[model samples]
Target: MRQKSVLVVGAGLSGAVIARILAIRGVHVCVVEGRNHVAGNCHTVRDQHTGVMVHAYGPHIFHTDDAEVWRFVNRYANFKQFKNQVKAQVGGGVYALPINLHTINQFFGKTFDPNAARAFIQAQTTPVIAPARNFEEQALQTIGRDLYQAFFKGYTEKQWGRAARDLPASLLKRLPLRFDYNDDYFSHRYQGIPEAGYTDMVARMLDHALIEVQLGVRFDRVDARGFDHVFYSGAVDGYFGHSYGRLAYRTLDFETRSYEGDFQGCAVMNYPSADVAYTRITEHKYFAPWESHERTICYTEFSRDCGIGDIPFYPIRLVHEKQMLAKYRDLAAREAGVSFVGRLGTYRYLDMDVTIKEAMQIARTYAKKAGVAALPAALEAAA
Candidate 1:
């Protein structure tokens, strides 16, 4: 009997997990990646000069509340404890991010306890804008104008290349201000980076007899004719040759600098001041604190409008983008023998853990039913 064959597009976490699960279930899988190597954005390589693991695209810290997702990643590679402690570079002073107790006290020059701090911040907020209209208004009503201007206003404008009032109120969905001193960026139960690197971990995930990985190969809809089913993790617009107008995205431009000693004394230092063109500076060596290096590499990240031939990073799912995304999704639903998966496919900003979890679920559903016909929302939503 001929074994069922499946095509997995884009060798990132989503494709890697799906390929592994389906292969384990007795299906033959072919993974094709346009880039010369696998692991897409999460691709990591050791700097020959510094011997430091560099996050080729940007920093990806695996932090998740889901126990299953944590265990799943651990199976591929050993993970080191990595807490993302971020600092913000403002006017003549540095402050802790997420606006915690220390940041509040430092910025205001007041020593207030947690209870007093909460009350003080509450006092600062004015009820001028009821049912806030946009990000700027929502922020002023929640964190007060003083802190909003200092922390969010300029940074938000620089990052999105737009004024705060122009952005959706949903962008600042929750009050980012914290009354406590917990400096950890993410509050998830599991947080860490792979000891070897994400690329190594993903490589292990694709290491199976049933899985065949071909790098530097781009697969189009025509190529789907050779396989029973296709799992595409590439941009939804790219899959259809971008028939509908292109969706808006903010791509990052990194200015890398090599230094003999520590540069910023931290992994990520954000510049909230609009005067500074770049958003943040990330020291790569700090990402893996467990490993020490004499030389360090830092990337000064600049966010701007994504252009042709540029790698899209953040999907700007504003009003216009959302409307355009609907048209692409409608086209995706009509396509046969193919399912769109992952951040680019769904047109949403997704964390690494969520990407892996969704991919695993999709593959498991297919394994249980022994056919793509039984796939879940990841497929049915488009259908």
Candidate 2:
């Protein structure tokens, strides 16, 4: 009997993980990537002039609370311990992000303990607005008008290309403000960057005997009839040629600058003023603080609507987009011998860890259905 063959689209974390899992189970896997490189948005390359590792698309810090997901990534590359400490530049002053105790004191010129600070902020919050309607209302009701204007309003406007009031309240739910001085951006237990680089780590993940990766190959050009199963990680709308209309997405434009020494004295610095055109500036060297370099590279990110032939980054799941996404999901469910997985495949913003975990689960499901050997209990649980 002929062995089963699988075609994995978009050789990013999702596609790479799925391809590796199936390849290890004696399945012939052919991974196709539209880009010339292996890793999609997480692609990292060393700068020729500065010798610093640059995040080709944008910064991607691997952070997860799941121990199984952390262990799975460690098997591929040595992950150095790294914490994301974000700073905000608001009203011509630098402040510690997440509206922590230090920020509260700095912004208000008062030293208040956790309880006192909590009480003070509560008093400042909008009393009338209960069950906030939109992003602006949520910010005002939760963090007060001053902090909202200083930290969220303008930044969100620039990031989404719309007024804060126009966006949904659910967008601000993930943002947390603390009464204590913990300046860590993510509250995840495991946080780090791959020591070598994400691309190197992804390449290691795809290093299997039964796996063959073809770069610069579009999935539409591939003849799907040749493969037993197809796992597509590309945009769902693109698969059917946008028959139900394109989903809304926000793409980023990075203005990278080379500096002699230290530029911003931090990894990430967010500009939260309406006057500022760009959103944030990220210094690449700070991402890998363990490694030292004389020169530094930084990227100033500007967000805009994703257009034709542009790489989609953040999905704007507004009412219209959600309706289009629902249609796409319906179309995807009816797709035979094909499964949609990952950020673009599902039309949702997903972190790297969640993307990996879901891909592993999908792969394990395929393996089990194909009557492959039962994976370890821990591995199955991890997926």
Best by lDDT: 2
Candidate with maximal TM-score: 2
**How do the residues 83-115 of candidate 2 rate in per-residue lDDT, one tens digit apiece?**
988999987789998889999999999999999
lDDT of 1 at 116: 98
Error of 2 at 372 (Å): 2.6
Provide TM-scores for the models. 0.95, 0.97
**Per-residue lDDT for 1-383 in model 1, tens only?**
56889999999999999998788667899999999988999999998989999999998899999987887789888999999889998889999988899999999999999999989988988786468889998887788888999989998998899889999788886436688999888888999999999999999999999999999998877889878889999999998888888998999999999999899999999998888999899899998988899999999999999998999998988888899899999999998878899998898888999999899888877666655334353442221
Worst 10 residues of 2 by lDDT: 374-383
Q: Which segments of candidate 2 are over 4 A away from where they belong? A: 377-383
Candidate 1 deviant stretches above 4 angstroms: 371-383
Residue pair clashes in candidate 2: none
> What alpha-carbon RMSD in Å does predicted model 2 have with respect to the real structure?
1.8
Candidate 2 at 343: error in angstroms?
A: 0.6
